[model samples]
Target: MTLDDKKRVLREMVLHRRFEERCYQAYIERKIGGFLHLYPGQEACCNGVMEAARPGHDYVITGYRDHVHAIKCGTDPKVVMAELYGKETGCSKGRGGSMHVFDVAHRFMGGYALVGGPFPLAAGIAKGIQLKGGDEISICFLGDAANNQGVFHETLNMAKVWNLPVLFVCENNQYGIGTAIHRSTAVLDQYKRTCAYDIESAQCDGQDIDTVYEHAKTAVDFVRSGKGPYFLELMTYRYRGHSMSDSRGYRSREEEDEWKQRDPINILRDKLIAAGELSMADFTAIEKATDDYIENEVMKFAEESPEPNVADLEKYVLA
Candidate 1:
């Protein structure tokens, strides 16, 4: 990536961090109701991967920690905030708050609320692409805990068997809600689990945007080349609890502090500064601009947008 490209990604990562921080404040103030998950430390995982893949062109789906991913995939940030606020102008028309943000026009399929639910759905999308002879690949982002589900194995096996172009990204944040992964999952290394299905896999430091982008670029290229499925496990952490309601009492403060020291945003910023590509003043300016955009634009739109009409409550129901 060029220096300018790195700078752009740095700016984007800053925006994502500030956006999620604002969401946390909104949730606390009761403006955003229901199961809000903030992606503070995991900014690089979404930004880096999206940078490697064509966001608006390729198919993207993930679990409920999805606001940042949707934005990276070209969904309007204002509409995402509106969705969290349950406004009629939301991406899902305010019907799918927090968890089910969807914008098919941009090909950001949807964020599933059920754990492991997106596994097979991603495969199905890839199968459709194969049948249609399309070059687009389906990307599924899920947490470490979701890997334990039956669908995880089933999806990988089927993806390889049919040579489906799908990339399964595991954001292994080390904890599933309140339980550390080791307590719930037998194999600690998430990438190694793909060995059962004979699919190629790798793991990397999720806090470093450069590292993620490099590895993700290779994985994306491999999958898009019609080589079947690839699994990438990113070792990262979430600064907040699993959801707005989670107290996060299961984890220790020392562990959280240690992870915070290697924060993704800071890693990229420091790297640029050391390389003489960016100055502290430039970073401060980027922060201010992002803050203004989120507050003046994103928050304002969500706050002023109209709530869903009472009579139209059944609008998008499939039944």
Candidate 2:
């Protein structure tokens, strides 16, 4: 990444980290409701991929833990918060909540909740692009656990057989719900699993923003070249529980702390600061700006976006 790009990625990673931090704080304060999943540790997977692709042209669909992707995809933070609050001005008009943020403008299909649901949906999106003679690419983001499902192999077989333009991103965060990857899979090389379909694949240090961008760029380009789907297994970890009410008895605090040491935001921040790309004052200013922006959005959503009139219920529903 260039110096300018590095600075931008650092700012983006911080925004995601802080945005998620604030979301968790809101959940604690009861200002935000519902099952809020924080993306504090997986910032690179969302932000790095966003930085690599054109938001309007490329499509990205993922499982729940979606707020970071919404932010990265240009959805207003206030609307996301409003959705969590079940307010009308939300991205899904207060219906989808935290799990289904769909933004057509950015080509973010949705935040599906079913473990491996988005796999085939993303394939369909890529097929649509191919039919329309467009160069757009679709990316399906799923956890390592989803890789075990029959849908994963089915999607891979069909996509490669048809030469669909898509990227299957496996965020092998080392855990799925509560089970470790090693305990779940006999074959731990998640990238090598792509060989079953003869697709190109690579593994990256998902904790490093630059490494992610570079590797994703290569994989995405390969897929876009009509070479078929590319798979990337990003070795990452989540700093928070799976959801709002997770007991978290499955992992150790020491494990979380060790991953925190390798936090993508911190790594990018340190690099930018050490390389004279950014200063502490600049970093602080960026943080303050992002916080203020989010606060302003929240207030705007609260004050300006009206609630859905009860009389209008069933209006959009099919008979």
Candidate 3:
């Protein structure tokens, strides 16, 4: 990667890391309400693939670990933060909160609450594009647990049969709410599950951006080149618990530390430095700038944004 490319990737990853850290702090401080999930460790997984996506053409739908997707897809952090704060300026008009950030303009579809709910929605969008004769594609993100949902299998069959252009990405972070994939999932190798339908598939280290980006180029190129659909299982680990409430006692500290040692952000940081593409001073500036951007720009915007009016509580609702 060129210096600019490396910087761009790190910037996006840093934005996610900083933004999520602040969001978690906000949640704990009672500044933001509802269940909060942090996307700290899964940065490279979303950043890598999104780098290959075209915002106006391609689309994305994902489960609740969605803040990174929305951010990477060009959603304004200000509005996204506002959404989490339940303010009117929020992307979902203060209704979607942390789990449901949707912005139609950017083609980042709903941040669905259900585990496997987004699978069909992604397929439907891909089908719509195909029917319209538009050459666009949709990507779906899910945790390993979501693979157990029936909708996953159903979408796989439908997508493969109809040749829908959708990429199913399983962000397997090892644990699904404290249950290890081995204990919960019968087919531990999730990508191989797609063999039944003959859809193209792959698995990669989610913590390595280069690995993911390289794999995404091939997978995305295949799907974009009119291959039915693709499935990729990202072997990753989430440093934080499933939610803010999780005590995380189900896993050992040694295990968490092991994964943490391979933190995606640091991996890229060291790579760029060793390649002579980045300097320590440049990285320090990035760190300061990231903190400043979130504190002064996003956090301030969400903090100062107006809350939704009680009178409008019945407005966006459909009875």
- The candidate that wins on lDDT is 1
Q: Which stretches of model 1 miss by more than 4 angstroms?
A: none
How high is the lDDT of residue 289 in model 3?
A: 96
Instruction: Quote the lDDT for 284 in model 2.
Output: 91
User: What lDDT score goes with residue 25 in model 3?
Assistant: 89
| Candidate 2 structure quality by residue, lDDT tens digits, 1-319 | 6788788778777777777887788789887777887787888887776677777678989999887787777877777777777677888887788888878787778899988989999999999989998988999888888988889899999999999999988888888888888999978989998898998899988999888898888987898888888898888999888888887899899999999999888788888888887888998999998888767766456546777778877676776
Query: What does candidate 3 score on TM?
Result: 0.98
Clashing pairs in 2: none
Rank by TM-score (best first):
1, 3, 2
Cα lDDT of all candidates, in order? 0.94, 0.83, 0.89
**Clashes in model 1: which pairs?**
none
- Locate the minimum summed-lDDT window of 10 residues in model 3: 48-57
Which tens-of-lDDT digit does each residue in 99-200 have in candidate 3?
A: 999988898997888889999999999999899888789999888999898988999999998999998888999888888889999899999999998888
Residue pair clashes in candidate 3: none
Q: Which 10 successive residues of model 2 have the least lDDT summed? A: 294-303
Instruction: Give one digit per residue, the lDDT tens place, for model 1 in 114-154.
Output: 89999999999999999999889999999999998899999
Backbone clash tally for model 3?
0
* lDDT for residue 158 in candidate 3, whole number 0-100: 97
